[model samples]
Each structure stands twice: as structure tokens, then as C-alpha cells.
Target: MTTTPEGTPTTARHRAPGAEDALPVPAAAGSVAEWTERYAHAVMDTFGPPQRVLVRGEGVYVWDADGTRYLDLLGGIAVNSLGHAHPTLTAAVSAQLGTLGHVSNFFASPAQIALAERLVALADAPEGSRVFLANSGTEANEAALKLTRRHSGGARPRVLALEGAFHGRSLGALSLTHKAAYREPFEPLPGGVEFLPFGDTDALRAAFAEGGDLVAALFVEPIQGEAGVRSLPPGYLALARELTTAHGALLVLDEVQTGMGRTGRWFAHQHPHLGGGVRPDVVTVAKGLGGGFPVGGLIAYGPDVAALLGRGQHGTTFGGNPVASAAALATVGVVERDGLLAHVTALGERLRERLRSTGNPLVREVRGEGLLIAVELTVPVAARVAADALAAGIIVNPCTPTTLRLAPPYVLTDEQAQPFVDLVAALRADLAAEETP
Candidate 1:
């Protein structure tokens, strides 16, 4: 067991023994090698091999089974809003579970209703806005897809998605995704989905100009997370809203990666500095919604859009479980009470400034708003940089061969963040030397 900052004890979870682990538990139960070998046989080969056996996490740091601690800059791909083992989050989950845990869709819990209200308010959506709970980001997008199709009224069936966009892995969400590798395996996906050049206003205008009437909705990520944290060009979102509205197409903003303060705003599209002032018909969010508690949501605005999906249209058994809802409620409460949105905004600016100030030869560019950032490398050695970063006790993700993504938890301190810039500078020098003749 590990103790949280509030002195609460958290049970460290370990994988139960499969038939293969019958040999015997190692004296060091946290040994990475022993656990890695067991994982290879029991788990599917989808994610290749496990990166490391993480035993415990507190704040912005996690300890591997080997007892080596690393600053978790990725934050579970932008899911841990409050960092790990937060007392507020823990207390909320515990108290809710003790009172009422899981409830069927037929029944409703206070947390379920309360969380929906909170999200609707946070969005500052128009009156009559509604929310649909789900288990993950993919499910949230899946529900949004169905709602969009229903709102299409059968006359408009074509949907527009940005190139390199990753909505989710479900059939409906995948249809909106543009990655060929993810979509190729599931051939002949749902038809009428069109791909547009990301950040290209002309392409967006042209697509709608050519097939405005046939288009049902246009899905966009305010900041493309998987596409290397690429933010849409200035006024791009506004233009999208104008074009979609003129064409009678609904603007569905996918905030799965940029929502819940990831971009220092409740929703990136709502950030005025990032080109807010535009309202979307549908917005899908997850990742940081439950603060690592595994919850997703679809927030629809306006009465017409909200009523698109009536009763019996769609639902989920574990969508609004009391435990998950309570977790989300507490997550939002803490973010608001602690003023984390403003904190994130300030911290993100400092991080970006420090990185750019390094003037490291290897770092080409650093881009992103708030905490959702990407450091573009001068050479395609991001994978190597990431590996070296791990060795140096810092965690980050190589989103592509040339792009390094950082989405550390909201609780990351300036002291912790400052050193990361220095680490990268040192790592870059090493990498540059290796490439030199």
C-alpha cells in the first residue's frame, strides 16, 4: 500500500497469477522483468510489449516495479486531470461507492444527474442542452455519431472529418477517423464520410461548397491530439461554424483530447484566445472527464440538437455508474475549487517559454495551448529522444517520428516542469552528437 499526500492509504493493484505464474511469486513482487514475462503470455499483442510495470503513482510521478520513479508527463494520454492518488478524487469515489455504486440504466443516481448538470453548465451551452454518459471516449463519439445521423433527417448523410483525426476505434467513430491503418482492417466502413485537409480553410469551404446539401455534420478537434497536438489555424473554427451553419450542417467538435482543462479551458473551443465565440451543435468529451476514473460524455446544445436522440434510441448499462459519476463530480469540483483552469493556463505558458528558450538545436518548434503541447524535433529522432528521456527519468510520448507530445497532470509544479526543459536540452545534445559525422 502507498500513502497519498493526505495520508490516505491506497491499495497497490497487481495482476492475478495466470496458469503460467504458478511457478512462484518473486521475492520482489515489483520486479519489472518477471511481470513483463508473465504479461507477454497472458495479454494480447495489441500494444506490442508493456513499456514498464508501474507500481504506484503520486502527484506527477510514478514508480516502476524496479523502484525507479519518473515524472509522468503524458498523464495516461491526458486522462489524469488531478494527477495520481488525489485525496478529493479518492474520497469522492470511496464515499459514493459506499453509499451506492453501480445502478442500472433503468434507475438514476444523484451523481449521474448532478454530473450532467455540471457539464451542461461548464459548457455554457444554450438552454435545453443535454448530456449522454458513456464508458470511454470512443463510446462518447459513438453516441455523438448516432445523434448526428439521426439529426441528419435521412436527407443529409455525408459527414466531414479532418485528415489525421482520431475520434475513436468503434465502427461509428472509426468511420469519422481518417487514419488508414486503423480503418483498413475494418474495410468497407459506414459510407458517406469525407476527409478534408486539416487546418485548410479552403478545403473545408470547398468541400461544403461542392456537397453542402449532402453533408450531415462536420467533426473537428480544436487541437488535433493524435496528429501531433496540431491546433487549428486562427479563425479556422469560426469559419467552420459559419460554413457549416450556412450549409445546414451541424458542427460536431471532438474535445476528447482537449477538454476538461487539458488545454487550460473546460473545452478548447470555448477558450476565447483559441478562437472561441462559436457554438457547436454537438461536443464529445472524455479522457480527463472522470480524472482517470473512466467516464465519457456527449454534450448536445440547442433544443433541436438535444431532441435528435429520443428515448429508446441509445443507452449504456455502465455509462453513468454512481462511482464513475461521483468521481467526475469530484474531479470538476476540485478543478473549480482549486482554480486549476487558470493554473493550467499559467503553467502551460511557462513550460512552452522554457522549452523555446532552450534554443536547443534538436528542437525545431513547440506548439500547443495550455498543457496540450507538442515539441517538434529538427530530425526524425523523437522515438530515440523519448527512450533517452525515459532513461533520464522523465516520461513523454513520441506521437510521431518527429513530434514529442507532453500532457502532464494538472498538479505538475514549476519546479518539476523547469527541470524537464533542461533534461530535453541535454538529451538533444546527446542525440545531435550521435548524428554528427
Candidate 2:
């Protein structure tokens, strides 16, 4: 049995030991089809059929079970910022785990305290901001939602969320999420919430006007990731902040998908278009924060609202696991030390330019900030295009029927982006041709 650098045990338990290294030259039996069949039997179908059973990854490239190498443009749905098995993240997690793996919330570890300090510092908010760590993006939002209520003293408990916003799937987070399909079946959710059209500052103002002090918070995503990387128009977030502040409501920015340098900024709201030099009261982050190790946090600014959650107000068993904190610290350090934020900015501009240059009639629009990007096709064949791209040895995501999203690792080089762009262009052409007849 061989262990990954992160100390993750890799044995024949998942597949034959060393089988990934000895993959066939031209083709292999361990194709997506074969591995997908095995996955179906062994794994739950929460995320649907496997697009590809990726067995190995390095930087921006991943090899599927079939030994087919593909440029991973999706970056595991924007979680692997430094790409798979980054040495920094691996070493941090391994060393921290060896020294201290986990401790109950009753007792804190240095890694956990350090991670919280780092996140709060990175937020650059006032000195009194506090942090609550969680295990996933949903948990972060859930914790933040609770904090909002605690601060409001239950008098103002209603929340105003954006129409296309995706906070999370947990009960509390789902309360703020606006998708009918995701929310309807799980009705009788935590109550007192309203949804408004995103980027419509007028509508947001109207909602607060109607609700008055009843609104506890306005939860929003600086850039809607699950909604096909949709971004708010300039000054929308600033307007929300102003309206919420005027109404004595908290402005919660859900940066689960847009934070951690994904959008060339520490937080997407830091963008000139979004916050316009404003600061939000609450910010929730996850995804790339740990660079693949699950870690999420909620940052509450100022003492007025920071200490709302007193003892026994909130807790989690594995929220601030030492190993997870260590992983996040390492990720943040690398991002800062290597200056990846600027890298993402430059590379994102190049990627967007190349994608537009494809000039395919099917591409209706291409939009996104930094490494997080999306291409909207005129027709609703994004799933087919994604599949075609996979077949052509490239990986991307069909976020909507007509929109394809790409969130490649920050480590992705221009050389990697070029071929992937070419492959997407070719796939668009092929799909267009197939539809012509």
C-alpha cells in the first residue's frame, strides 16, 4: 500500500495498488464506463452518474480510470485551488495530523486558533471581527444564519436572499437558497425568508421597505456560481449593504464559491464592481479555502454583532479539525506567498479573451471574474458540449442547459488553458454541425 503525500491511504481497496501508474498506453479497460459502473454499485448517487472516474491528477491535468489524460478546467468544482496533491497542502495536512488530528470543540488546537486568526486578518475587516469554523460551505452559511438571528434578538428574524443565490443545502442554509426544486420537497423549512431578483437594488430596497425591521439579514452571493457564474451589476452589492444598514439588517455575503482567490481577490466582494469599497457584516467562505480539504468559516464583523453567539449558541464536532485548519493555513500561505491572486487575474483575462475569440455562433455570451468563468451557448446543449469535451480529453462543467462553467485551479498555466480552450471551441463546432442536419 502506498500513501499519498497528504497521508491519505491509497490501496487496492479503491482499485488495484499501483494500477493507476501502470495504466495502458493507447487505451485501458479502466475507462470512465468501467469505473462508473463500479462507482454506481459502491457509492451513493447523490451527484448523479460520474462524468469520469479520475484516478490521478497533477497541477491542471487529471487521468481518468481509462488512462485518458484531460485538462481539468473545473478544478473539482473549484475546490482544488492548488490542484490535486499540492505539496504545500499535503505537507501541512500530514504534519498537522501527525501532531494533532482532531479535538472536540471544548478544547481548541493551535492550528484551529491560527486558522481563525488568519481568516479574520485576511478579511481585513475591523479588529473586533470574530470567526466560527465549520466543515462545509453549507455549515458556514448555517452558522452565519444562526449568528444573524442571535444578533437580531429574534425581533428581526426574516432574511432577504437573492433569487439565484445558492447558500447551501442544509436546512438553515437551504432556508436562504431560492431554488424551487431544491427547496420545495423539503418544505416547512426554517421560516421567515424572502427572495428578490439579483442585481435589482430597487427590488432589494423594496423588500426591506416592506419588511422593515423584520428582516434580520440579506444573504447574497457576490458572484452566483451554481447559477452559471452570474455576477451582480456594478454597485448592486453596495446598494444592498446600504439598504440593509438603513433597515438595521445584516448584509451577509456568501462567498463559498467566490472566495479564496477564485475571482482574483480574497473575496469576490472585494472586486470594484461588487462592494465598491464597502464591507459586509457577515461573510461565509469554503470551497477553495482549504484547497481540497473540507473547511468553511463565517466571519462576523464588529463587537456589536460579533459576540452575539455566546456560549452554547453554536457548536460542531469536526468544525475546526486541526488537520483541516492546517490545510487551510497552508493554502492561504501559498496563495499569498506565490502571489496567485494576480496570477488568477491575468490568466482569467486571457481565458475569457480566448473563449470569446472562438467566435462560435453557439456561444451567446462569456462572463465571469478571474479563474471562475462561464460560457453561455445560444442553444441548451451545454451538457452535450461538456460530454464531448470530456470525450476529447478535457474537463469542464455544464452548470445549466445553456451555460458551461470553468473554474480551473489557480496553478493552471496558459499552456494548459490554451488546449482546453481549443477543445471547447472544437466541441462547440462539432455540436453545431451535428445540429445543422
Candidate 3:
């Protein structure tokens, strides 16, 4: 037994060669209450209290500090593309870190270059398309924001975003987000950002109709995740594309939560119902890009757009690092090698159909493409239902007051997903029984 400098007793599981007191872990590591108290003291209270002190995870199952297991349906809010501790992702990240982990922005690594090329090819980007690597969805949006600013040689200063849009939390990205609660606190954001009604083709046309040349970019999410996984209506995206092209304003699709096969397509915008035949000038991607690893980037399509942000204009220290790139590459490799795209499509449709087949009055509708789904409730009991679902050992997200969002891992089995369907049906039965009384 040894004591940390702060006097917490610890026992070393393994001491590395020539390392002094390394990994002198606290003996009472499994006590959830103790860990939660420590977390309140040590971590910022940004996201309120911790839900559960999860310790270990494998596949779609995670165990809390109390040894209770949970079926992860949220997939870390759609980041765990291949689920937890995937062998391929682990091997790739470990191999890369052991080889060449990081370098300054002035230098480039083989893994970074390879991943960029792979993304460009997978996106079907034309000749001279380029990618600006970043560390998260926010950073990727920041890069895209800068690209929009550099458009029209600064003559067009106005940018358009959508209602219920969640671009990111940073100052620049914050300007484009729609929720007033998120924006009011961070007021005096970057100017000239106007939020239009979501998926309203007429509103989009009217915005472009007035001072169309003043608009530099039109930002949108093919499927709005934080806004309850709402997809754009038919012809809405096509109308956005036509207007932006006619007015010379760049169409920026924020695919942070909807890209990298989350919607069964390589990107959500490629789906016919969402954004078919729409060629966006800028595309931002993150979330599932590196499975559970933190990595994100923006793709600038065509040589004209790619040529914008040249030397000394933008850069990052950890972005495009070899280790993160290797993780993402391995994620893509696994998705391709295992044909998870088709799997996700079929599984997602089956799950949605199963929910609908339950004929539960509590369930208003089931929507979204691929594994990214939402079960809309007829009543505003999403939070209560989500808590109940958690108690039943399945994890889900109350994305909105009336919607339960389910962005489970693509590796989730049909059997693993049945519990949620059963939960909905039981809730309906409970409601009926109460009404009879």
C-alpha cells in the first residue's frame, strides 16, 4: 500500500519500468458515490451531475461502477460507430501511437495523408478537393465558418442557418445555432447570422430573394440531431441547393451527427429523401468519424472551394495526428470490410418497423434513416420514458420533450434492440390500464 501526495491510499497493480509512483490508483475506485463526489469537486459542472459512473465497455454493453450492465443505445451520442473496444480500432490506434503519434502542423504523417485521401475519395469529391482536419465537431465547424467568411472575397458578410440547428458551442459556431437558451447567454456572437425556419423552402427562397448576393453561406444539417432527429422535408434540400447555387452563396451541410454512414449512406445528404443530387460547397463531419476516438474535419469540394484557406490561413496542432487518423482509418476499414452500411440500413428499418408493429398508442411515429432513429411520443413524457428505459437497462436519449432518440451502435443485434420496443409496448399497456380505472 502507498499513499498519493494528497493522502489517498492506493495499491499499484503494475509499475512500469523506471517510472516513479506511476498509476498508483486509488484502492476504492469502484465506489460510485466516492467517485461522483470527487468528480463534482474536480470537474466543471457544465453538463450537470454525472448520470452514471461507467467503468468498462465491450461491444454494445457497458458496466457501471456498481457492476450493473446497460445496453448502450445512444452509442455515445453517435460516436461509437463500431461500439466499445472494437479490436480493429484498438489495434490501429495502438500501432500508430507506437509508431508515429503526433507532430507539429508544419509536418505531416503518412496516416494523416492517407485518411484525408480516403475521406475525399469516399465523399466522391472532385479533383482538387481538400480536407481540414480538426479535433471535434465544434472545431470542424469553426474551420468551415472561416471558409464561409473567406468566401466572395468578403463582400458577402451575411450567413444563413436554420431554426433548431445545433452547429457547435464555440463563439463562431454559436452564432449559427438556433436555440435561444444556448445563444442568449453567449450573445453578441458573430454578426450577420440569421436563423430561418427549418426545411421551409419558401422561407429559404425569400431570404435569397432579398439581398441574395449578401449571403456568403447557408448552413444546414441534412438531419437535425439535437432537434429530435428531424430530417429535412422533401424538395427542401434541393431547393436550398438551387437557391445557393443561383445566388452564389455556398451551401454548407453540417453532417457532424449524420455523416460517416450514420444514415446508412456515406453522408446523410446523399440519401434521396433528404438531400439527393445536392452538391454542397462545404461539408463538416465528426461524431462517428473515428469511432470512439476524438477526431473531426471539414471537406471543401472542388478546386475553387479547396483553394480558399491557403498557407498561414488555418492550422491545428493535434488535428490530423497519426494516432487519431489511424483510429478513423481503421473504423472506415472495418465498416467497409464487414459491409456494415447495408447491415445498418436493414437493421435500422427492421427496428423501426418492429416499433411501429407494436401498435402502441404511446408511440406517435418512428423516423430517421439507418440506425439513427427517433420514436416520437404522443405525449411529452420523453424524459420520464427515458429514465424508465435506463432503469430497465437500456440507454437512450431524450433529444426533445416529445421524442426519444435512438442512435445505437451499428453492431447492435436485433435481439439487443428488442428490449426498447418491448418497453414502448408495455408503457402503452400501462396507460390503457390506468385509463380503465
Candidate 4:
């Protein structure tokens, strides 16, 4: 048994045989229609109608309530780094939970401390680097925003983000987001944030020049996942770093969707040809960190930035949780031990090569690094293609009217990727015929 933060004793979850059998089953759990109906009444409608009621997953495939298996090309929007039911991740999470699942900020756990150390080392952060764990991508960005404010005690007020960037939906993270629809709804947001044109070097330089000393920080997604896997222009990140350093502003890289080996590197920013060889003062990441177990973090590069937050200025009850930390540690371990990063690099290259070889007119371009790919279409038929893909036992995301984003699991095998590649080869041909007559 374990106790709540308030010391209320509670029964600990078990992994013993038949333990899952004790789980309470929803009356509508057996069917997609029934579950969707129940979800409509009980859950928030934030994501719109249910696409399919996914029941379980394994390796790179997921099953719906109707027992239909799908080749999950999106990997739960890039969160499932290790794919589903990974034994290492499951064992780590299970063991940690059975021992110590959570605790208040007042206390500490071995898992939390070890995970922080690992992140700092992986980042190649200089001495005095520190890590702040959060529960989600938005929370990680929020913490980073606060850290920047503490830089020079709010003297620098201007913050920079790029157009077409999607940081998160939280008010603080949303302020850095570029989509008008996602931002305008919340009229009153924290101020001093400006959205720059994506990869416009002149605009970036102008922002630094205009903002001058008031530039507190600039947040960038090394590869803008929500903007159809758009990668920054070559040297863009290095230039941002130079300017931010010269202007005395923080250069923050948001790696939420591209970190945890999603791009065949530990972090997307490490990819020199694409993400640039720049070094950021602070880095925020989440998505694939916990391999779908909900964990995020902010890494302060050195002592000066690390000391900005100080103590009592920030706190979270569930951040740095033992189970989450364990999950992350396990995810990283498997990626290393299984040499999945190399697999990701080679497999992504193969898939892109195959797609580009098709010479399909609808395949306007294929961009992005490693497994995070985008097939930009010549027409606004991405939604139609995605629907077709769903019907064909594959799962993908139409990130835009003409962009299909694929961020498959790092463990995706060549055999598993062939179906999606074949679908792309023929999809546009079929659509082309439709528009012809």
C-alpha cells in the first residue's frame, strides 16, 4: 500500500496474474459506437468526433474496439517512441509504481534525480546544467517561459516564436503558438510575445534589432511538427543562437514532438544538416520522453540560467514522478540497447527514397528528417487521403489541407513501413483520376 501526498493511505496497484481482470469494465467498452457515445457524454469534445475507439496496441500496430488493426504511422502524434506494450517501458513503469509512484515536491525520489542527470548529460550541457520535470509539453514550455522571465528579473520583455508553430494549447504556451484560431479565443494572454515568419533570416534579425535589449527569449521547434513537419532552413538555428547570444536573450528550443529519438537523434536540434548545429540556452521536450506515459522537461544549459528559477518560485505535485522518470529511463535504454536510432535513420531514408522515386505529381515534396516526415500535396486532398488510409488499415495525420505528417515509432520495421509507402504511391494517382473528369 501507498499513501497520497496528503498521507491518505491507498491500495497500491498490482501486476500479479489476474490483476487486470479486476478492472471495472465500462458498459459500452466492447464496441466502438458504444464507447464513442459514452465518450460524447463523459469526455470533453475538445478533439471533435472520435476517429476510432482504440482498445490496445503492440509494436507498431493498434487495434480498435471492432478488432481492426492499423499500422500506426503517427505514433500517437509522436508520443509513442517505443511503440505500444514495450516490455522494458512497461516493466520500468510497473516496478516504479509498485514501489513509489509519486510524491510532493517537498520530497525527492531516486528515479527523478537519475532521470534529470541523464537528460543533462544527453544534452551535452555545460557544467551547472539543471533539469525541471513537468507533466506535459505545455507545462514544460510554461516552466521555460517562467525561467526566462527570471532572467534579469523581467527586464527583458519581448519573446519570439515563429509563424505556423504549435507549442501547446495552454495559455502560456499558446502565447508562443502562431495559429490565430488557437490564440484569439483566449483574448487575454501573457503579453510581449511576437510571432516571426518561419525561416526568414531578415525577419529574425529585424526582431532582434527592434526588440534590442528587451528580448527575453526566442522559442523554436527545431522541426515544426504541427506545421506539417517543417524543418528550419540551414543555419537558421545557428543564426538564431548567435543573435540571441549577442542580444543577451535566451534561445529556447521546443523539442516536444521531435525529441526522444523521433528524428533518429536524441533531440531534433542535434541534426546538423536540418536542425542546425546551434546550441540553445534552454531546451524543452516531452512527447516521446516517457514513451506515451506523459512526461516533459526543461533543461537549463548552465548555472546562470539554472539559478534563475531559485526555490519556491515554481512547483508541481506530479512532475518528476518516480514512475514517469522510470518510464523515460527505460525508453532511452531500449533505444540505445536495441540500436533503434540507427534503425530510425536508415528506415526513414529508405521510406523517403521510395516515396520520392514514385514521381507521383501529388507528391509535391517529402520533407523532414528521420521518422518525422511530411508529404506535401499539390492539391487540398490530404483529408481525403487520410480517410483512405484509415479505410486501408493505416493511421496517419493530415496536419494541413495539403500536408500529411508521419512520425512513426522508432521501432518501425521496413516491412511495416512498406504499406504506407505503397499507399502514398497509389493514393495520389487515384485522386488525380477523380479530379480529371
Q: Write the per-residue lDDT of candidate 3 for residues 53-135, one digit (tens) a residue.
A: 88877778788888889989999999998888776787788777767888977899998999999989888888899999999
Model 3 Cα shift for residue 376 (angstroms): 0.6
lDDT against the true structure, per candidate, is 0.87, 0.85, 0.87, 0.87
The lDDT-based order of candidates, best leading, equals: 1, 3, 4, 2
Clashing pairs in 1: none
My TM-score estimates for the predictions, one after another, are 0.92, 0.91, 0.92, 0.93
* Per-residue C-alpha lDDT of model 2 across residues 213-260, encoded as one tens digit per residue: 888888989899999999999989888878878888888989999999
Model 4 accuracy (lDDT, Cα): 0.87
Residue 420's lDDT in candidate 1: 79
Off by over 4 Å in 1: 1-28, 429-437
Indicate which candidate wins on TM-score: 4
Reference-based lDDT, residue 424, model 1: 67
Cα lDDT of model 3 overall? 0.87
Cα deviation in Å at residue 159, candidate 2?
0.8
Candidate 1: Cα lDDT at 24: 64
- Candidate 3: residue 102 Cα off by (Å): 1.1
